[model samples]
Target: MHERTHKVNAGSSKPRRPAAAGRSRRAAGFTVLELLIVITIIAILATMFAPRLYGNERREFR
Candidate 1:
């Protein structure tokens, strides 16, 4: 029978951070430019579709 021995190092006490730790520190928010772009896209889409939505609703109520 063969026995394998495991060795633990005492010099390093804190556990090593995972590879994902590098990515986890990112600030969670949209930049101003990104937010403006998203808002502009949404506004344009709403403007383009608003007439159709309101027009149909008005016709249905009559």
Candidate 2:
């Protein structure tokens, strides 16, 4: 039986594949500012449009 051989160049530079989403090199968890900004945006939109939504007691929960 004969075995096939394959060779790759060592001198050439190659681009690396991108990481898949939800898989992070760093530890998970959002920064304070980032989370605050997101929360603030949601709050602003909710406050501005909450009245228009039906049911005054409880319209929706994010």
Candidate 3:
């Protein structure tokens, strides 16, 4: 692949910025509802398994 270089001015120069109407990459990530749903599912699973794991404190009589 050929290398394409952007030659900048020797000094005292700044790159141009995109106009206001341009689409940027900053508009991404999870929404609050999605996060809440994931958290709720995890909580439910933990609750279901916690009792089985911790409820084994049986005391057998001699």
lDDT of each: 0.85, 0.74, 0.75
Candidate 1: segments with Cα more than 4 A from true spot: 1-26
Cα lDDT of model 3 by residue, 10-62, tens digit = 77488766575344543467668999999999999999998887676543332
Worst 10 residues of 2 by lDDT: 53-62
Better of 2 and 3 by TM-score: 3
How much lDDT does candidate 1 score? 0.85
Error of 2 at 25 (Å): 7.5
Candidate No. with top lDDT: 1
Clashes of 3: 0
For TM-score, the strongest prediction is 1
Candidate 3 segments whose C-alpha is farther than 4 A from its true place: 1-27, 57-62
- Deviation from native of the Cα of residue 31 in model 1, angstroms: 0.4
Q: How many collisions per candidate? A: 0, 0, 0
lDDT, candidate 2, 42-62, per-residue tens: 999999888777566564542
Error of 2 at 48 (Å): 1.3
Candidate 3 TM-score to native: 0.46
User: Tens-digit lDDT track for model 1 on 10-58?
Assistant: 8887666688887766566767899999999999999999999999999
lDDT of 2 at 5: 81
